[model samples]
Target: MQTELSKRLGVEYAVFGFTPFPAVAAAISRAGGLGVLGAVRYTAPDDLARDLDWIEAHADGRPYGLDVVMPAKKVEGATEADVEAMIPEGHRRFVTETLARYGVPELAPGEAAGWRITGWMEQVARSQLDVALDHPIRLLANALGSPPADVIARAHERGVLVAALAGSARHARKHQEAGIDIVVAQGYEAGGHTGDIASMVLTPEVVEAVDPLPVLAAGGIGSGPQVAAAFSLGAQGVWLGSVWLTTTEADLHSPALTRKLLAAGSGDTVRSRALTGKPARQLRTEWTEAWDDADGPGTLPMPLQGLLVAEAVSRIQKYEVDPLLGTPVGQIVGRMNSERSVQAVFDDLTRGFERAVDRVNRIAGRSAR
Candidate 1:
């Protein structure tokens, strides 16, 4: 299960698990796989620093990475205030009416405020990168695009490797041009902001385009056979996200977990811009359908769309709004039928990789030679 990438990262397994849960990230790193914590949940620098402190204390000296989304193209000069101001009256009314129709309750006083759609914007992510560089992180990953030239230089100055997620070969090449150390070729079946290319078609193309630099395959990969398929496609490693959503360590809310377990299938998810401005894969829900409706207010772009629905999302989760409660998940959600610990998931990945290797050996048929 080891590759050059794993050796470079000082991990025993080349499996990279990208998750938002700090606990899940630490667990996977402790279990020999690279666990990359998604930093989108941490809008404030102090919050991110505190979480990294915890990860450092518990990761058993295993290296882990930080993932942040700073897109290459976004509305410039769009502050939180600007974004709020940009939300149309119709869109706001749509959110209000939808929540009312669903009977979703309002957040109680002192309840955690809904996530502000401010962090994914460049300014906040830059601050996040600064905080991440201050820690002893082994890798820094930009989810939406290549890291800025200065950001890459700064990470390199600290001996931290820079990785970026690419939806196509062209994007991979652009990352290379931007001096990215690693490229994660995430396919259409992946969770959250993805492009049209499927992993099977995208992986080998990215591999060839970014030769001499390692490419990690993502998208509809959940089983051992999928891992083997990724490697056969010339990927140096497999990056899994959705497989961990149902894990015990995952921070998914009860209603979301229930929906994931009882309803989600390979075909149950859809890619829509209803959640965030960009098209991202998520379980089908009334939230998405409402935005897709002909009579519904059309979705806004980027930070504005997220701003427009932030309160609605909070109310939906707080009240367990059944028809609209969903999270970003890939098509692999179908295989996530049961809750397991992070250690169990790691063990399964290892066992699956072994079985895949053995099957390949059997197919080679040494006796025939």
Candidate 2:
């Protein structure tokens, strides 16, 4: 169905798939849904440009989008210098000691020299935006907050729609003020960075708060009933993240994690700031447990925390270690065990929506009768 969102993005359905892999972005767009490439992992301009080029080539000319983390508030300018300055000597020492405790080796000569905490937020994001604008991306989305006004203006000038993610109605209003074309009302159940509110309650609150602006429901939505509930609550579409992690096309999925996700319950995930310096929902693992322990060193803010753990996470993945590392995931992971194609996932959502609509109509008909 061509809802306002679909019309805005010139897509066939309102389903938006968010992922870091370019292949996933291309696949979702090919499947008649808007796929958004998460650009946070691209550490350099050339890296982002390459990924965008790959996505464009594989997208088959179908519309897609790009998402960047542009936090509304930061440590004022939050440059690499500022981040380095703010990182307490004790915190850096703690990071080094923690890695040593885990038997993770120190970086080689000239290896640690390139790792600057604020590179993504300040430099890389700008580079990504420049590359994305040159491409045919239909939408530009900000993950943490409303994008900078200049960024929004630049997108608009290039005839692209701008969207921002929000955890509350208050945040929605802020996005609206910043001239964001869409608001993704994410709840506590969302993977990665998220707020404390539940989706069922937050969706309607955001929809009501940002009347004319479209709201997309996010968090804990993996089934047809969930999509129907969001639509009924005035959402124009649904944004899905964790559900796709277990998909066959996901570049990051491993057999061990796939099995773990299938067996996980809704309560298996926890919101911890251990990874990103912001409360993000991810599968509970020894890594997360270690950070939450009072005896353990507390996490650093945003980029610093991310920088500290990047090497450890890479090592864990390189070693295929399950107990030590897990990626960001939501409560929806429990229902995401099966390995399905992107097209198959879209088909399931369509069928679910139809069944849910039919069930509602039947109930209404019975009440009338």
Candidate 3:
């Protein structure tokens, strides 16, 4: 069904699936939903080129988009090299020691090289934007904040629709000022980096604040009823992230993490700043618990903290020793019990939406009678 969002993006459905995996992106697009691939960690232009090319080939000509992080603030006068230098030696040592305590070992030879961390710098993000612009991406989404004026101007030049995520009405206004096409009113219940407000509260506030600018409801939206609620609240579509992580096509192959996600309930996740410097919702694990410990060394600032823990996080994943090594996720993980194909998930959602709408109409009819 074509909603205002579909019309705006020239897509077939208003269901927007976001992921870091290229295959997932292609699959969602092919399944009649818009697929958005997160390119935050893409450093080398060629890497992005290859990923986009792969998505284009596999997408069956269905439209897709790309996401990048453009934080509204940064350390003063910090160049890429300078940011890299700011990563403390003590933080690195702590990461290494923590991993060792958990029985995760150092990366082996070529493995370490392949897992090298990149793209946490401003220049690197800009470089990624340059590469993305050269392609035929239909939509460009900024995660952390509104994009730079130059980025917006350049995307407009190429006819790419720009979207940004906002946690509050204030942020929605800022996105409007930045000339963004869509505002994802992500609530505190959303996975990854999120704000303090719940979806039901944030969605209407953002919609009212940024009148005429389409809003997408995100955060804790995992079912058809949730989607209907979003539309009823005046959202043009829904932005989903955590719901897709447990999909069969997800890149998370680790048995431990998968088990945790499947077994988790809505209350299992927590908002912690252990991964990125910002408060992000993720599964509460031993690693995160350690960070919350009163006696432990506190976390550093954004990119510096990310860089400090990258190598150790890699080791944890390589060893398959723990489920807490990854980044943020939302409380919706509890509902993610099984790994269904992307198309199957979309079908279920569509069916659920229909049922929910029918129920609502019946209730309204009864009230009128």
Backbone clashes in candidate 1 total: 0
Supply candidate 1's per-residue lDDT for 12.
88
Instruction: Give a tens-digit lDDT track for model 2, residues 13-110.
Output: 88888998788889999999899998887777788788888889998899999998766666555455566566677766766666566766445656
Please identify which of the two predictions, 1 or 3, would achieve the higher lDDT against the true structure: 1
Single out the weakest 10-residue window by summed lDDT for candidate 3.
112-121
lDDT of each: 0.87, 0.82, 0.83
Where in model 2 is the C-alpha error above 4 Å? 76-82, 92-119, 366-369
Model 3 has a clash total of 1
Error of 1 at 368 (Å): 12
RMSD of each: 1.8, 2.7, 2.1
Ranking by lDDT: 1, 3, 2
Q: Which candidate's lDDT is highest?
A: 1
TM-score of 3: 0.94
Question: Weakest 10 consecutive residues, lDDT, candidate 2?
Answer: 111-120
Q: Write the per-residue lDDT of candidate 3 for residues 1-369, one digit (tens) a residue.
A: 568779877777788888988989999999888899988767687999899999999999888999988778866555656776877787777777777677776777766523433565667778888888988888899988899998999999999989999999998999999899999999999998898999989999999999998998999788888899999998999888888887888888577777778888888888877877778898888888877777878788787677666766667766667645554678778888998888888888888988888889888885322
Candidate ranking under TM-score, highest first, comes to: 1, 3, 2
Candidate 2 residue 1 C-alpha distance from true site, Å? 3.3
Q: Write the per-residue lDDT of candidate 1 for residues 183-280, one digit (tens) a residue.
A: 99999999988999999999999999999999999999887888988999999899999888888887776655565554678898899999987899
Q: CA shift at 71, candidate 1, in angstroms? A: 1.7
